[model samples]
Target chain A: MSPIASNDGMRPWRLLRAALCVFVAVCLLSPLVVVLIISFSSAPFLQFPPPGLSLRWYMLLFSTPAWMNSLLVSVELLVPSSILATIMGTAAAYALVRGRVPGAPFIMACLMLPIVVPGMITAAALFGVYRGLGLNGTLTGLIIGHTVLNLPYVVATVASALRVQDARLELAAATLGAPPWATFRRITLPLVLPAVLSSLLIAMILSFDELIVSLFVSSARVRPVAVQMWSNLMGDFDPTIAAIASVCFLFAFLVLLADLALRAGRSLRLT
Target chain B: MRPIDRRIWLLLPATLLLTVAFLGPVGWLLARAFTFPQPGFQNFELLWQRPVYLRVMGNTLLISAIVTPIVVLLGFPVAHMMAHGSARLRRWLVFLVLVPFWTSLLVRSFATAILLQRHGVINSFLIGFGFIDEPLPLLYNLTGLLAGCVQVLLPFVIFPLYSAMARIDPALMKAAATLGAPPLRAFVRVYLPLTLPGVMTGATLVFISTLGYYIIPALLGGARQQMVAQLIQDQIATFGNWGVAGALSLVLLLATGVLLALLQLTVGLKEIAR
Candidate 1:
């Protein structure tokens, strides 16, 4: 590292740099912090530095069927889609990494199309196709849509991990009289398991947070929390949404914290 | 032929799933865009001839253009700090970045609504402090839309830029300094040029994502300020005009394709997966 670029050197510049960093960080984080505070407000409306602390909104959120049902719907879709995406993604990653699949690059690009294309386009297209297939507004449709949306992340993560892994182990196992399935199960799968799990978790998060596609594909019978939140924001302004935001914030935080813990543990094992 | 390659079989399930579930729908939409409503490029003609359709497209591009530079300007310093800081500081900075990065986009948009509304935090503070006699119009406008977009895209810019900057040797800067160049000159001449790839990558990613963004623009940008996504949704949801919607989607798909191709050339295909 350059001494001039070091934090210890150039006092005024360092101070300015430190201030800008803190300012930007605070600016980025302020909204979430404000939402957390507002969720606790006893007042009926969104009041900042809220009137007083209470779990009234949270209680209200749980008591309301629409909000609670939406939450349940989101979880239902999140779990199935995450699992489906993970399985497909892990398989695709394996093929791309080790399989003698022709046109691996083209296949990888196609897999990533969902990530690159605008989501509204996907949602609209699915809306039309599902209308014909009688799948629109069904939970299965949402799951399929979400699984496609999430497949890329899982594939990328697992594929990157597989790229760095030593293939010699799989070769050795096969040479030592292990069948293909046995070699994969005992050697290849075990090594990439952590990344596969990470991809699953990340896929779950993506499904949970998805809004635009869900807005298009979901019906009143199968609305996700994000769709519910969108309708709620448009129709009314209330702290109940704040309460819901806080619940989501907490859910996302816990999942991310778990992901971090998993990563840290894996790194420690490697070291 | 002891055993067929398992890899080929492994790819089959995903390929089947994507084809049936994912590509099938998109392909159907593309087909409908051509044939729907007794159509023969009428939808495309509508997009080309209509003033409102053109306006939304222009608005989407304008907002992205405005947001990209601001995000880069704000992201550069933080990324610089993260790249060059001590390990402990780097850890803290990464946490600060990742928390927002991982936070739900819906939650972030809602927070922006709460913070930028007429009586929201910023306006309320300004009024209370007597800085303004009346609340300034912030929400449901371009300002609110930009705020939401920038926050969402900032981390995208920072991470790529930081990665690129980190790869550069500090010794080059030190050498420039030793050769009697001033600090600013060294940065502008040596350090800046080296980090150009990162800046290009971050800027392009932010722009492309912004162009495709739906939720923030839909929620924070109110009915008055319609964007391309909103227009497409309106075509389908309100008008039930699938042909027009499909046509609009094709336009967006084409734009995204071109930009992504550019990204591939500049940042490499591997950088995109990350």
Candidate 2:
């Protein structure tokens, strides 16, 4: 809250800023908007001037067994991987923050290194090792890969939340005849709960959108949506790809929206 | 320190999982690339002599160098504007930057293909406007690949730089201005130097990600412009050339490590993106 609101109007610089902002936003949103419209198209093919609108394309998506199976697989992988990644990340953050573990900085770096390294390289490297160990084409392998990639985000987000925490709050609880477990259960965990939720949602998104690693490590058994989309693209640029993509967009939006709502509610509780 | 707390013991599971899942894969692959059965420098030597391999490496570096600096140069003005703009306006700009953030890179690349192809919206628009007799070479080439890469990497550079720029206090700039330094000079002497850490971060993020990308080149670039990642991918998936694939993989891994380490230790992007 600045005292000065800067509420003046009709400035040249402001107009220029508006134009640039509008252009970037339009560029970002228009592709998905176009794709969403075409998903409801009546044309037999991915025709640009789509003949008409209907839910037939979506119905077609639902009817296909392979598409249905892939969607199910994506959900199965996302939920478990997100949960596991969150747990591991929170535990690691707690350990590193609370204890003077030797080589803590280096350990933190190693835990979050996948975020910096290119996914393609990581995918290739993982493919070789899994194939060597006979872990390729299994749901177990997909979970392992997805968890590794998502863990870093969880660590970073939860760490930030934990770092902002007040130590005296825990000390205050301890002074009030509270046991260590009670203090942690009643105070420490609650403070970082929103961050935990945020990390989990982000993990789910990462696992959902992942394509390159799935392409390498997975086969027919556990194909994620992104992997299935690649086969559809290469097989002949199937228009159902767009239909499914729209479904995915909506799906991701809802999940993120839900997370934001949860965050707002949680903060209300804290206040 | 106070013998490990019970809560702190939770770290073992995470450490063990990372060891098996992440570091295990990476370390094992690097080692396997060298000594699956026996060790030798022969695998790496081939990486140097193969013309295609050399050309692809050059292409990788060239693309990274070209695309990153250009994005930095262009992104600075926009990020700077956002930093000083009204709060409401800044929020809208951030949303604009992040809308594509939610979408997968695969989806964005596909859209870029549709937008830039010969019969795509862009070429068709220009041809329809009588700018050229023929549809200009827009898609399935070097130029198209560059265009898509720029769009993808722009946000990565912008976010970090914008974060840094937005943190600069306005009072410092006002002081410089009041001391008879023109606005341009004040920005050049004060703001520019202060934001070098951000510039370094943006450049590292862009350069590293660009070096390891395969999709943009595979979809948009012609055969003449194949990058190192594409070459390695083709070796394994297309040709099933295991020995060459291993060699190429090692070459890429070592090259990126050495380059990134050099950049990290010397130029110091640690304070920025890391």
Candidate 3:
């Protein structure tokens, strides 16, 4: 690393850089910090330095059926959707990476369309199709929508992991009389298990957090927590919204920790 | 003829899922712009004829243009520090950035709302400090919308910019200095151009993302701040106007495609995949 500049003329620039860094940090973090604090506020409305700390909002969140049901719906939707995405995505990543498929890059780009395209377009399209199929407002519809939305992430992660592994290991297993399925199960699967598991967690978090598509496909009866949060934000200015937001924040924190633990000893890539 | 590769079967499941659920539906929806309500270009015509539709489209582009530079400006220094700072500092900055990145956009927008609302944390703090006599109208306006978008998109720029900066050779800067160029001049003349690929990618991403935003504008913005995505939703939900919704979706998709093409020309889409 380069040494820090020591010239007196450079001191002013260094100080300015430090100040900007602090400003960016505060901008990035203060909103979440404020929400966490207000979630525990005893006041009926959103108040800062909150009148006093209390669990009433959290209690109300648990006690209210709308919030509880949406939470349940989010769990149900993410579980099946994430599992399906992981299975399909892992298979696709493996095929393209090791199967020597022609036009792999083209296929990969097609798979990533869900992510690159505007979520609004995806949501509108699904909402239109589901209208004819009688799938809108159903749990199955939410699952399908989320699976498609989350497929690219899983494929990207697992494919990157597969690229870095030694393809010769699989060839060796095959030459040693291990059948293809057996070789995959014993060798490739074990090696990339962490990435597969990490992608699974990532898929779950994405499905849980997805909003626009859920807003279109979900109804009042089958709303996810994100949809419920949207409705709450539009209608109310209460701390219960903060409480639920904090709950979502907690879920994200746990997932991040699990991901770190799963991928320990490996360097993290920001992309 | 050579037998087809058996491993191609592995791709069948995902391909089928995407074809049936994603491509087929989205394709059919966009096609409805022509076929719906008697197979004419009336939907596109309607969009062109109405002043409000055009205004919303223009407004969406304008907001995105405004948001791109702000995110890049705010993101540049943080990315710079991360690229050049000590290891411990880098770790801390990464954690700070990732925490917000991983958090749900819904939650972050809500948190931002709480902070920007009248009598919210910011206003309360400012008033307590005797900076203002009355609470400022920070929420439900352009200011509120900008705050929400800038905070959410900072990571989009920072990560790309950091990757670019990390790849830059330190000797280039040193060489410029040895030539008697000052630090600011070197940064402007030698350092900036090398980071252009990252800047372009980040700016394109921010611009396109802001164009498609729905939730942030709906929650934090006033009626005057309606964006194209919100307009598309209104067409479907409020009016059940499928033809117009399809037309608007076509426009939005084309804009995204054009930007991606531009990025591919300048930096290669493969760089983004990396």
Candidate maximizing TM-score: 3
Q: Distance from true position, residue B104, model 2, in Å?
A: 1.2
**Least well predicted 10-residue stretch by lDDT in candidate 2 chain B:** B265-274
Using alpha carbons, what is the TM-score of model 2? 0.91
Q: Which residue pairs collide, candidate 2?
A: none
Task: State each model's TM-score restricted to chain B.
Answer: 0.95, 0.91, 0.98
**DockQ values per model:** 0.65, 0.43, 0.72
Model 3 regions more than 4 Å off: A1-5, A267-271, B1-3
What digit string (tens of lDDT, one per residue) describes model 2 on residues A42-161? 876665546798888789899999889999999999999999999999989977876657777788888877886667667877887787788888888899999999999998888877
What do the candidate models score in CA lDDT, each in turn? Answer: 0.87, 0.77, 0.91
Which candidate, 1 or 2, has the higher DockQ?
A: 1
lDDT of 3 by residue, B1-274 (tens): 4555788999999989999999999998899899888699999999999999999999999999999999998899898999988989998998899999999998998889888989888898999999999999999999999999999999999999989998899889888887888878888999899899889999999999998999899988889999999999999999988889899999999999999899999999777766
Interface RMS for model 2: 3.4
Candidate 2 vs 3: which has more TM-score: 3
Tens digits of lDDT, candidate 1, A202-257? 99889999998899899998999999998998887799999899888888888888
Residues B96-209, candidate 1: write the lDDT tens digits: 998888889999999989999888999999999999999999888889999999998989989988988898887898888889887878889999988887888889889989
Clashing pairs in 3: none
Top-scoring candidate (lDDT): 3
